[model samples]
Target: MSELIARYFDRLAGREDAVLTDLSGGLRRSVTGRDLPDLTDRVAGWLAAQGVQRGDRVVAVFDNRLEAALLLLAALRHGITLCLQPANAEAQALADLAAGLGARAIISAATPCPEGATPLTLEAAAASPAHPAPDLAPQTPFTLTFTSGSTGAPKGILHAAESFLGCAAAFNRQTGIGAGDRFLNVMPMYYMAGIFNGLLAPLAAGASVVIDAAFGTPTALRFWPRVAEEGITALWLSPTMLSLVMRLDRGDKVLPAGFRRLFVGTGAMAARDAQAFLDSYGMAPLQSYGLSELLYISVDDPGQPHFGSVGRPLDGVRVHLDADGRLGFSTPHAFLGYLVEGALIPPEPVFATSDLGALEDGILSILGRSDDIILRGGVNVNPIEIERALAPLFKGRGFCVTGLPDATLGQKVVLVFEGATARPEDDEIWARARQIVAQGPGRAQLDARAQIAALPLGPTGKIRRAALRETLAAAEGAA
Candidate 1:
C-alpha cells in the first residue's frame, strides 16, 4: 500500500468507529473507519477470485457514490490497476472507453459491457467470497483517468500511489483541511477537480466527505441553507456553479455561521463573481490553480484571501510565466504520462500550459487561456476587457467574447450570450454592446452577436473555448 493510505489506516487504529464518509444524493450510506480493513479486503479478494490479479486493469464507471470511493481505496490497498470513468456519461461511449482500456472486467450495473468483455457489478463484486490478494509495491501504475477532451479526444492519464498520494498530502498540509472538517462535494468523482481536490485531499486529512450525487441547480439554490443544516464546515464548487448559485441566491442573506471554507477551482473565477460571493457570505472563496496532470500547483491561504487571485504556490511547486504571460510549472507530483494504445507516452520535458496568467506579489491571477486573447485589426484585444465593459448591458446574465475570421479585419470580434431566446430587441442589444465597447479604454470593437441556449462547458464548469471557437468559425463560414 502507499504510505499515505497506510498512514490513514494508522490514524484510525484506535478510532475505527469514527465516521469517514457520509454518502447521500444517489446512494445513502455512512462508512466509518472501522469498515476499511474488512471492506477493502473483501473487494480485493473478490477481484482476486475473479482472476483480476495485480497489474490487470478494471474500469469502474461511477458518480460521487460510496461504491466508487471504496473500490478506489480497495484497489489502491491491493495495488490493482483501476481506471475510473464517470457513470453519468453516455453508456455506449463509456463502454467503448472501458473496452479500449483492455480491462479485465467492467465494474458497473448501469453501463453495458462490450461483447466478450467481463462485467463485475459493484454489488456482486463486494459480495464475492474472499480470496488471496496480490500486492504490488507502492510506485506501481495504479489509477487511470482521462483528460476532459475539450480541445480534442480524451487522453488517458496514468498515475501511481506515490504521485497521487504525495499530491493529496500536499493539499491537506497547505490548505489545513482535515479531521473535524466535513466537506460537501457535488463535483463528479471521475474528474480530477472532484476526486483529487474534493475526495483524496480530504481523505488524507482524516476529514469526512459528504458526496452529493444529486447536486445541480436545485441543490445550488439551497446550497447555503443545506450547508448550515448539515454542520458542514467546508465545500467545493466550480466558478460556473458559483455564478449560477449567485444568480439564484434571491439576495436573502444567510450568515455562514460556522462554514469556514468555500473552495473554488476548475476554472478562473471572474472578479465580479468572486466579489459577489464575498458580498453575500462575508467570506471569500479560496481559489486554487492546477491541472489534472499536475494535481495541484497553488492554493489560497484561508487566513488571508486576496480576491481575484488563485493565490501562492503549494510546497515543492515552481511556477514561471513567459514574457507574453503564458503559465508554466514544475511540480514533484505530476502524473506518470498518457497511456495510449498499449504504450506509455511520457509528458513533455517542459510543463507549459496553454493558459495565460500573471503573478503579482507572489499571488497568481489567470487572465484567460491563450486562445482567449483576440487579435483584431493588428491589435491584441482581450475578450475579458470587452466582457467586463458589457456586463451591465447584459445585467451580468452570462456571456463571452471571441474573435472569428473576418474578410476585412483579419479577425472580427463577436459576442456569445448564454440563452438562445431570439428577442425582437436583439438588434438594439447588439447596438448597445457596440456602444459599450466603443466607449471602453481598450478601443475594442464588437462586430456581431449570437445566443446559445447553453455554453459548451467541461464537466468542471470551465468553458470549452476551443470548441466554442470552432463552432463559431463554422457558423461564420456557413453565413
Candidate 2:
C-alpha cells in the first residue's frame, strides 16, 4: 500500500498540472501532468469495470499511443499485474504471452479481442471513482515482460514492485537525470529496457516522456525536429536505432537544439558506432548491460566510456564470475522467473548469463556468449570477436560468423560473407581473420576456418545465425 512506486504515481496524480507527452504527434506531443492522473484513473476505472480486481492479470495490446502509457500507469496504480504484448506481434505470440500471464482481460485498439479474454477499449474506459488504494506486497508482481526470443521462444520475466521502483532509483543515481528533463521513447514498450528504463524510470523521476511507437529511418529523421521543438533533453535507443540516427546525420539535423544525454543498449554496439556518435554529435553515449531478468544492472554513465565494455555493476547489484568464466549477475530487480505450463516459477537467481565476461579492476569486459561459441579441436572461438574483426575487412560488405554442427569438434566455425570483393578465396579470408585474432585475445587458442558467401540478416538487421548455420551445414555436406 505504501510502496514507493505507488507513492510516486500518487504524487503525480496530485500534481495534475505537470506535462507529459506521447507519440500523438508523429514526432512527439506534450501532455500536462494533470492530464496523466485523470487518464491513469480512467484506465484503472476501465480495468475495474472489466472485473480487473487488484493484482488481476491484465494484458494490453494497444498501439504505441498514449493509451498504452495510461494503461501502464493505471495497472501499476491499482496494483494490477500488468502484462504487455507487442501490438505488432503475430496472433500466436500475443496469445502465448497473454496465456502465460493468466490475463483476465486484454486492452486493444482492435475490436473483438482474442478469445478467452474480455476486451477494453481506450475510448470507452471511464474515470475511476475515489477509492482507497489496495494493499499490495512489496514483491507483488507489477510487470510481466517477455524477452525478444531472438535466440528462442520468448521468456516471460516477472518483476516485483520494489525491483521496478529500484530501476528508476538506479537510473537517477547513474544518469543524474531528474524532473524537468524530457525523454523520448522510440523503442517499443514491450521491451523490458524500453518499458522500464526508458519509460518508467523517467516517470518515476517525475520527468516527461514522449513515446513514438512507429520507429524507422524516415520516422527518426522526422522526429528529430520535434524533439528540438519540444525541448527534449534525453532519450534512449537500441543499437539499431543508434546506427540509423548516425547514418542520417540525426544529430546535425536536430539533436544539438534539444537533446542532451543518450542511452543505448539491447545488443552489442560497435565501437565505430559509438565513436561516430561522439564525433558527430559531441554527445557521449552511455552503454548499459541488462536483460529482461534484470532491469538495469550496469551502465557506463554519462561521460564515462569503457570503449567495448558495458560498464560497472549498478549500486546494490553484485556481479561475479563463476569457475567456468561465465558472468553471473545478482540484483534486487532480478525477475521472479518464467512461466511454465501456467505456473510462474523462479529461474536461477544467480544467472549464469549465457554471456562470458571478465571483471578486472572494477571494469567488466564482455567476452561474447559461451552458448554461441564454436568449438574446433577443443578450442573455443567467440563469433562476436570474429565478427567485430571481420566486419571492418568487409568494409560495407555483409558478413556473419556462426557455429556449424560438427561431429568431431562439436561445432565448426563458419563465416558467411556477402558482397563482391575482388579477392574471394575462403582460405584467404580465414588466414586474414586468424592474423587479426592472433594479435587479439585467445590468440592461438582459436582453431577456425572462414567461408565467403551471401549472408542473411533478419528484419532487425541482426545476423540470422540459425539460418546461416543451416546453410553452412548444407555446404559442408556438399563438400
Candidate 3:
C-alpha cells in the first residue's frame, strides 16, 4: 500500500489550487498544489520542534477542524504515532488515555499546555508558515483510536500509515468517490471509520469534505440544508442518527434535496431500516461494518446490497471464519501493534475479530458479539437475529435486545426500547417476536422459554445491558 498520508500529500501536490473548505461558517479555505507542500512541511517542522521523533506518540484532542486534519497528516508524514482523542472527552478520560498510552506530546486547541506533555496550540500551528517535510520511518505507527471497551475503560488501537492508505483504497473501490464528490464528516475524528472515510478518503481522492464541529440530530438536521445548498454528493451517518432522521416529521422534506450515496456505519444497521431510508429519501443507504482495528471491513454497494448482510468486504480485504466460527480478516490496512508498557507491541497481522460471522458464497453475514450469545436452557440465542426480527415490526423505532441471566434457564433474552411510538400491545409484540424466532436460521437452538422487557437507555443512546440485567435479576429475586 502507498505510504498513507505522504502518498495523499503527493497526490495533492500536483494540483495547484483545490478547494479545501473548513465549513465553520460555510467559509472556504483554499489549498493550492503549491501551498500544500509548504503546509505539510510546516506541520513536520512543528512536530520536529516539539522533539516528536519517528514512532513517538502525539495525542491530538480537537474537534473536526482543519488544523486537526493538518496535525494528523503531518504527524503521519513524520512517522510519529497520531493518537486522536475526542475533544468532548472528559478530562479524566483524557488523563487516563495519556497515562495509559504514554503520550509524549499533545496537540490541542487549548491555549496553555496540560500538566505534563508538550502542547501545540491549534491557532498557532495553523498560523505557522509552510515549511519542508521531515524525514522518518515508513513502518511506524501513524494513528491511534480508542474503542469503547465493555470493561468501562477504553483501549487504544494503533494503526500504521500503510493501513490508513489501504483503508482509503478500500473505500475508493467500494464507494467510487472521486474529484467532484463532497463528503460530510458526520462522524468524529476519534473513530477510525470517521477519520479514514470522512477525512482521509475524501482528501486522498482529491474530493472536498465538510467538517462539522460536532455530531447530533440537530446538527445533522442543520447539515441537510447546507448539503442541499452546497451540492454535496455523499454523506456518512450512524444508525442512531439515521433513526433520528426517520423520526423527524420534516425528515422527508430535506433528505432528497441532495446526495447521491449515503454511507452508514459504526453500528449494526437493520436491512429493513436501510430499505426504509432508500424508499423514503430516494437514495440508497450503504450499510457497512467497521471498527478501530480494521477501519472498514464490509460495505453495501449501491447496485448490489445483500440486504441483511453488511454487504461485502471492501477491496484488498478478505474475511475468513475459523473452524470455531469466529470472524477473522486479512486486511491490507492493518494497524501496528498497540502500545502497552511504554513500547509498541505489534499486533498479529491476521486479526480474528471478536465479531461472529459466516461467509456464504462470498457474502458475509455478521452475528452479534461472539462471546455475548445467550444460552437459554442449553440452547443458543443470538441477539442480532432477534433484533433484526423485532426491528422491522416496529419500523423507525429504537430498541436493543440483550441477554439476561436466569436461575431456571442459564440465560433469558430481554428487550429494551427507547420509546414506543408504535405502541402495539406487549402480547402482540411478544407473539410476533416469538414467530420471528421460531422461523430463524438457528431456531432449534432457542429453548422456547425466553423473556423480554422494556428498559431505560443511557444518555449516549446505548442500552445499559448490564444494568437492565441487574434490574431483571432483582425483580426476579423479589418475585
lDDT score of residue 435 within candidate 2: 78
Q: What's model 1's lDDT at 395?
A: 66
Task: Output the lDDT of residue 244, model 3.
Answer: 81
Tens-digit per-residue lDDT, 1-479, candidate 2: 65686667764655544445665444444457666656666776667777777878877775556666767777776678777665655667667666766777766632345554455545565435533456776677887766556577767678777777886788677778887688877666655665676678888878777776646766567666756776779887777677766666534433546577888876777777688667776777888787667777777857667767787788888897888888888787777788656677786768768888888777777878887887776887888887777766655456677777778877766656565453556567667876776787667333544454556653335566666776767877898
Which residue pairs overlap in candidate 2's backbone?
16-34, 18-33, 19-32, 19-33, 20-31, 417-453
> Which digits, one per residue and each the tens of the lDDT, describe model 3 over residues 242-276?
78856763644546344788887767777787777
Worst 10 residues of 3 by lDDT: 444-453
Error of 2 at 12 (Å): 2.6
Tell me the lDDT of candidate 3.
0.68
Total clashing pairs for each candidate = 0, 6, 4
Candidate 3 at 476: error in angstroms?
7.9
Better of 1 and 2 by TM-score: 1
For each candidate, C-alpha RMSD in Å? Answer: 2.8, 3.9, 4.2
